[model samples]
Target: LENTEFNLLSMMYDVANILAFKAEEKGLELSCFIDPYIDPFVIGDPLRIRQVLINLTNNSLKFTEKGEVSIRGTLKEDLGNRFSLWFSVRDTGIGIPEEKLDKIFESFSQADTSTTRRFGGTGLRLSISRTLVEMMGGSLSVSSVEGKWSEFKFFIYLEKQASDSVSRKDIDIDLSTKNILIVDDNKTNRDILRQQLLKWKCKVVEAESGKAALAKMREAVDSMSPFNLAIVDLQMPAMDGLDFGRLVKSDDDLKSTILVLLSSVTNKGEIDTSKNIGSSRYLSKPLKQSDLYNCLMAMFYRESKSEKILETVSEPTGIIDGVKILLTEDNLINQKVAVKILEKSHHKVACANNGEEAVKMLEADHYDLVLMDCQMPVMDGYEATKLIRSKPEISAIPIIALTASALKGDREKCIEAGMDDYLTKPLKREELNMMLSKWANKKHKQ
Candidate 1:
């Protein structure tokens, strides 16, 4: 058993982000809620826990056609160093019939024969999930309403590392009097944000659209009780986040309020535009409470310290031009496409057909970063990264994995192999540039 100390919230966030694309593709909202009472740090097999979570969540997404899927963790019992945590994966999906529920966890078995034919799964996910949960000292159970919804719940015990627990009162920033505004087109999204903000003791106002948000901001300012911050959604109907932020920042009255723009995609252009228009921060959607808290803390605590807040809360502004990049790929077409994109950004680009060639090139020359492809002939990116990391002369140069695989755990696999970052294939220019810019300032070995 790999019992190690890790942050439960961070692990859940990783699972949520890894599956975010699949959730988006299905047009289903994927959200996670971790009860604040749950100990943040616990001793257990994080990998195993993460595996069970991914499997269960994947199963829920597979069966769900519309609506939402939510993963939640709540504290069942807390005894200082030992705690019982309850985890549930709930979905508004096709539910298991009461009669067939018993067979759902069987090996190679689904709810029914028609499910097997239509879903095209080996039906092993639940079997594995249940086994994993039981192995971790938990009994997995399910509840369903046949045609309505399904929830899989389990309770597991974990040993919390003996440390001083930090509560909201212990935090450095006091949010008790802060008035925040949340703008999102979806009620569920708004509710999620509202709950989190309320938990932090901040007063919150919700707006269903950018226009409504603008009205609220103006009204509050005129009433002499302006919102301290406005969390705006990027993709809204009439007036999106950028337009709303432009109006807010342009006005002398509302300019002092912090603006945070949330987007589902990592579009570099949008990030740059948000920053240029005086937005204080940009965060990803299906927002994590921890991230939002950190952003707010940075914004409020270092209100006058623009440089410090930027380093803490903001994305790298724009493309870092003129850095030399090593592109490693066995596919000729991918190499050509990447080189063209890099050259367009005014970056010096070099190509390697495979990992071995890439290593040889790196040894012979200096590059700011290595864009390593995960799979190739002779050697793969993982082995190449290991080899590069072993050599002190080249170890400090950043290695970013470029792969077409969006499979579960692919990102963790890349990081475990010593890659600094990951980028899925069919690359977007904006995302590529943003990733490069993020690592461009890394202290490279001379």
Candidate 2:
């Protein structure tokens, strides 16, 4: 029960989302997806797995200036209790030369010496990622073409968890006969979205670029079956989403078609501008089932709040949303779960593998709060809390105990050792939200 079946889907998407923002900065899109049938949970060091994804995703983004970087996760073998999962990261960027591909995984070596200058990396990230994958009894492999694309994948075995649940995706509007257009330069992105739409019985059409999308729409109009919705990437060659929207709105027949602008980055100004230019709504990537589903709902049926993406999901957003938090947890799975929840709400998280590491991080940087796991090898939370309390400057900072023991006096032990509050293991989002909201409000009052 203490850190077994970690969610690979959650880890992959989380890492992708974090890195997608970086890709977006350079006018590129980053996308991540799972097979949907793949077991959501797998046995592994969640943090290490996340680290592999982070390294690979960031590497792809770093090299890619245009087009997209994508991550895909699939189950190769479902062995009931254990499964073999294959994860891959692909990018439409400058790829490795045939000769250099063999050495990219070697320490201090990259595809080219000039790459080190053009793209900022130590060239050690891929080596470290490969090492981490191998440590989990997996092998990392790569295949790339020069000036085109690169894909890195690993096959890892993991035990399945008994107690796991996947979120349900419910569409409010009927997609049975709807005609949808998906426009993205990336084949992976376009294919994934097209497949999902097809499964829902929607008539799907795809275009690799904005010009092609416009031509498709014009053809559809001539055939008398105009697309009901268009999901256009914000960054595209020839014509961007904004320009496409302006052209679409200029035509009377096409103006009736709903437009949803998709971007890896959630820029308020861009979203507003898209709406002003005739886009029905804006959705941020990496796209999730919930995002796609809700986007469809808004575009077709929900007219009141169609323009704003989840404008009321949580108006009085948790104070932790944008706050800096230090997570002092030893268990990789637990750390992943907690960090995932915190990040979904937009909080910036820094992790400490153990109490000693947490102390070092705390001294080196500032965190608004601490989530301290009680059990650790190098330094336990109790002793770590005492040391942190001993420091005059940070003594006033809040420390919350995260413990697996629900036994009597556990709370008292945490309090006695200087933890300001207690949270049980497998923390619930509601409890965390309330705890953070309470502490954040208290801190604000102070």
TM-scores of the candidates are: 0.66, 0.64
lDDT of 2 at 337: 94
Candidate 2 residue lDDT tens string, 1-446: 11344455555665665565467567776788887566564566665566567667777877887888888888788787888889899899998899987888887786776887878654456777787787778999999999999999998888775643332212333488799999887787887888667656789999998899999999999999999999998877788888999999999978889999887654656877987898888888787755786678766777765534333221223464577889999888998999999999788899999989998898888787899999999999999986775454455467889999898667656754656677998899989988888555434322
lDDT of each: 0.78, 0.76
TM-score of candidate 1 against the unseen true structure? 0.66
In model 2, the clashing pairs are: none
Best by lDDT: 1
lDDT for 136 (candidate 2): 77
Clashing pairs in 1: none
Determine the C-alpha RMSD for candidate 1 after optimal superposition of all C-alphas.
Answer: 10.2
What RMSD does model 2 have?
A: 12.4
